[model samples]
Target: MWGSDTDVLNLALAATVAATVAAAGWLAVALARARRAHRRSVDERGWLLERERESAARTAVDEERARIARELHDIVSHKVSLMVVQANAAREVLDAMPQEAEKAMAAVESAGRDTMTELRHLLGLLAPAQDGSEPAPEEAAQLTPQPSLSRLSSLIDRFAFAGLPVEVRISGEPRPLPTGIDTTAYRIVQEALNNALKYGGGRPTEVTVRYADHSLRVEVLNSGPSVLRGDAPAPPQPDGERPDGAGRGLLGLRERVAVYGGDLDARRRLGGGYRVRARIPLERA
Candidate 1:
């Protein structure tokens, strides 16, 4: 009996050792896999971070380009529109008023030179070496004498000189307005005139300013039979949706009007013309 018991005890000891060895091997394989997975996760995280950084850099570049384009559009379009108007006027009177045509041609040359100078200066501002780091307050200060409502008479006279018969009428006493509203109002009229010169059939343009208790109203009406021509941009749609290819000036004006919590309406008149109307609040925004 004692010999049999010893054999059984030895067999049990051997089985116990085999089971312990198998358990330890399984644990070692699991630990190695866990380490490898951790390393791979760390590498993927680094790649994702680098990609995000690259995306951010590209976004910043695109935004800067867009801002520069907006500035160019405002400055170049206004100057170019004046030049076009003057050139047309010079051609029309070249035979009748030799001296007046000479003056109109001179105005066109001056406008072209001024626009080039401003474009060069603005391009330089984007150069890193020139400005070093100017993107905010200094820019506004650098752009001097921003157009305003107070300067309406001078603008109208210039258009008149270009042979676009523009008449001005004012209602309610003119008073001080916030700088933003003043600029916006002027741009509204300026853009309307630009459209008239481009698309209206040499119509009589009327600009009216009506000041009220809490808001200011501006309207530019182009009246003539030529407005019915298909060549002209689709007259402002009453649906408030701008038609494609009408030009960006009106679209930009719409954005500015919305910025100040105002309403803008541009549509064909029932009688046969194009009319632009903007109502901007006078109270502080």
Candidate 2:
């Protein structure tokens, strides 16, 4: 009876050991699968992060390109317009009015020089230093200051010299504005005046700037038959079409104003001319 009991006890012990071994094997397999899944998840996250960085870099580059294009458009369009007008005047009076022709030629030269100066300033700001460092003090000093409302009088004078008479009116106390707002405001007036010069049919233009407690408003109005100087009468275009191809100037202005959370309206007036108005909020700016 004692021998039979010992055999049964040994058999029970063997079964327990076998069950424990099977359980350990299953746990080992599950651990290996879990490790592999974690590794795969980590690799996928790394790839996604890399893709996001690349997308962000591309977006930054596109935005910078757009800004440079806008700057070039504003500088070149306004200055070149003045140069063209002066050149035309010079040519028309070269024989009969030699003195007046000389004066016009001088104006052309001045406008050309001003254009080069501004272009140089813009390009200087864009240029990278040789060692990818900040610009040297001397080099920075050579760059001309950007146009602002303070320079509006000179801007108007240039237009008047080009045969576009401009009258200016200011309401409310003029105060200092943020750099971005000031530059944008000046550009709005500039582009509007340029449009007037090109299409105002030599009619007198008016520029009004109103400063309010919370917002600034600028308006440009010109009575027009919409004819280009020294050329045949321009054909009637579809509404919203400008003579300079697709009205890129106005579109750029809109984009600029939108950046500052401002509203821009450019439309043909009820009676006969074109009007451009922009309202920029100072509080938000």
Candidate 3:
């Protein structure tokens, strides 16, 4: 009886030990499965984040490329348009007025050469530079032009010829400014007048230029009916939509002003018309 009792006790103890081992094995497998699932979730989230960053970078590059394309169109198209108009008008006089035709042809040729040079420059901006290559001196010279404060009058006259009456009112004694400031100011005024001529359609334009202590102010006003004021308001497109090729002119103007740390405001006047105001600090000069 005592021996039978001992054998039964041993069997019972062995069965209990085997049951504990089986439970531990099942628990370990569940834990490993949970860990694998968590790791997979983390990897998926990381992949999504990387994709979002790449998308944003691509969007930025696209916007920059479009802006550059607009600038090239503005500079090249304006010059070519003027040249075409001059050439056509000159052709009308070739038979009737030989001397006038000769003079007109000379002007046309000069404009053509300038247009070609500027177009080359616009294309050069797109080309990839060689590895640390030094630019030829002559090429550098050609790229640089004498853009100074003294060119203000000529710029004004060009707009006046384009049919926008520009009134240049200069205040304070004229002093030499730094090249960067001078060129920026000149371009600001140039773009303002161009906007007036292109959009205003022969309206009276007012240009006020003032130079004070370490500051320059330029204001261009055109009393033309604003697009918003008109009965037909141009419908705004959704994001990523581009305007007609010609409509990017103002966009180009805005970008040009921004490069000099200047602010340009283009909006409709309360009474009637459009106004462009730009303020640039001259201290940098």
Candidate 4:
């Protein structure tokens, strides 16, 4: 009887030890699985962060490109159009007045050269440097003589040469304006005149410049339907206050003016024409 009792006690002890070992093995397996899941989560987070960084870089590049495009468009398109008109005039009068034609031809060449030089200089600045070197003195010269209201006459002269004369009327004193205002004003007039040339069918156009206490007011009005040229987006119809809700060019101008915090009204006249009026508030640089 004593021997049987001893054997039962040893068997019970052995069973408890085996149960302890099995529980420890299960715990180790669970720990290993948990560690693997944590590693995977960390890797996924890293990948997402890398993707986010790349997306931000792409956005910055695109915005910069858009800014560059807007700056060049007004300058290039308006000048080129005037050049075309002048070239046509020069050709038509070539046989009649050789000297007069020569003068016109010289003007055309000068305008073309100036436009190309400025554009080239701008593009060169935009391009990545070929080597770690600064731009030369001659290269810097191209950027000088930036366009402003002072050069407004030259712009008007170009258009007049094209035979689409704009009557310039001014009310109020002229003072030094900020760079942004200067650029915006010129662009508004440039775009308006360009539209007139494209859609006005050589009708008379007027440009009114009014310098107010708070802002610069400019009006470009033409006597014709506000039609756009060849597949170009139509500008805002004369019916509405917003300048660009109707056309691509005005739309671009709207965005530009908004950037400067200005007010613009473009609509059709009941009598017989289209009008673009912009009041650009004067602000500091």
Prediction 3 global C-alpha lDDT: 0.66
TM-scores, one per candidate: 0.63, 0.79, 0.56, 0.67
Clashes of 1: 0
Q: Which candidate comes out best when scored by TM-score?
A: 2
The better candidate by lDDT, 2 or 3, is 2
lDDT of every predicted structure (CA atoms): 0.77, 0.85, 0.66, 0.75
- TM-score between candidate 4 and the true structure: 0.67
TM-score of 1: 0.63
Worst 10 residues of 4 by lDDT: 225-234
**lDDT tens readout by residue for model 1, 1-285:** 999999999999999989888888888898899999999999999999999999999998986776577557767877797898889889998999989899999989977887777676677667645547655666655644656888899878777766678989999988988887888899888878766765565679999999998899999998744334544555554534333324566776777788788988887665666789999887733
lDDT, candidate 2, 1-285, per-residue tens: 999999999999999899999999999999999999999999999999999999999998998888889889889988988899989998999999999999999998998888898898888767867788987798778776888999999999999889998999999889999898899899989998888888777788899999998899999988775333333434545545484423877787788789889989998665656788999988732
Candidate 2 RMSD computed on C-alpha atoms after optimal superposition onto the true structure: 4.8
lDDT score, candidate 4, position 224: 65
Can you list the residue pairs that collide in candidate 2?
none
1 versus 3: better TM-score goes to: 1
State the RMSD for candidate 3.
8.3
Model 3: runs farther than 4 Å from truth? Answer: 1-67, 91-98, 128-132, 146-150, 160-165, 173-184, 198-205, 222-247, 255-262, 267-274, 281-285
Evaluate candidate 1 by giving its C-alpha RMSD to the native, one decimal: 7.7
The stretch of ten residues in a row with the least summed lDDT in candidate 3 is 237-246
CA displacement after TM-score superposition, residue 30 of candidate 4 (Å):
24
Separate clash counts for every candidate: 0, 0, 0, 4
